[model samples]
Target: MPHRKLQPGRLVLASHNAGKLREVAALVAPHGMQVVSAGELGLPEPAETENSFLGNAGIKALAAARAAGLPALADDSGFSVAALGGDPGVRTADWAELPGGGRDYTMAMAKVAALAEPHANRRAWFTCALVLAWPDGHTEGFEGKVHGTWVHPPRGERGFGYDPMFVPEGHSQTFGEMDPAEKHRISHRARAFALLAAACLPGAG
Candidate 1:
């Protein structure tokens, strides 16, 4: 299938996460697109029933495109620990699920550390699957990952999700400790967006 030419215009971002919205807005800003969050448009959040990041990203993107009748972009991202045999691959946010469905990364991070304490391998990686969907169902998916090691007593307070517990290889500070600009340069989401931009944005490649 020919890639859909994603010309600049209003695009619906299929997410309610403030951090994700901010990151995505920055990524697409140079393309001359007006980003509008699905939350702001009163679009209902869609359930992520898929078992993989790419599946979930497609689900969200398609849902938003159908709901808003506009092109949509979505991402499903999380951490996978090698010691746990990727036990939290798709359930990263729900592994130590919070009551009332809120995310508690601090508690989740502690749980991961405890589970990984006895293992010699503390290796882990973050994966992000990004999707862009058109109202007619033409969709594109891109994925990226950042390998790192898990740290106990999670450091920093800047980034969200499992940032505090992860220290990228060759980097001294945890992502949560790094400045946003610094983190963006090496993040999984940024990597995926780089590919997407090269393929979809004019003059970006």
Candidate 2:
């Protein structure tokens, strides 16, 4: 069945990642709302100083909501290695000193691998925290995750960053090879957004 549209309004998508922006676009596309990102709005970027994903998501959402004087949506997500004691959990995007701040996805994954033990029992999960903030001070938050194991030799090129290594539970293919539609079906983020859309979209009764 097709998605129902939401009442048209200006909702802010507080994010810097282009992939995230695109994904959110598809989620809200049926809503018939004009969505804009912080980057697109030329708003001052705020630092994510909160202690957790939900905290960080709220910080971003509140900032955008205040700036846009409208409801705002924000998502913060990261991967966790069960063996690593859930490290790189909220710090999925670690910054190394360099031009554009070197992004070391390969090194990060490798580090996670090296940190493992006993045949590299690579159990891991991807987690996403989403927050929706309204100008009236109403806020909603949700979390979703896909449990899976890490692959020795990462495969595929269709996804960004860690997609090549994460094999969702009950499947051998990594997210990098899952394609857009495939990923949406079981994605942690999508599940969370589904709740958000259903509650706020038009004609939800």
Maximum-lDDT candidate:
1
| Weakest 10 consecutive residues of candidate 1 by summed lDDT | 1-10
What are the per-residue Cα lDDT tens digits for candidate 2 across 1-205?
Answer: 4432335788889998888888887887777778888899887768989878899999898888888888888999888888778877888877212356767677766666767645455788998888888766667787888899887566888766677879999987898898779898898888778777776666442
Error of 2 at 13 (Å): 0.8
Model 1 lDDT tens row, 1-205: 6566798799999999898899999999889889999999999988899999999999999999998999999989999999999858889878767788777888998888899889999899999999999999989999999999989898998989889989998998999999999999999999999999988875587
Off by over 4 Å in 1: none
Task: Please name the candidate that would achieve the greatest TM-score relative to the true structure.
Answer: 1
Q: Which stretches of candidate 2 lie over 4 Å from their true place?
A: 1-7, 95-102, 117-120
> Could you list the CA RMSD of all candidates, in the order they appear?
1.0, 3.9
**Per-model CA lDDT versus the true structure:** 0.91, 0.79
- Backbone clash pairs in model 1 (N, Cα, C under 3 Å; residues 3+ apart or in different chains), count: 0
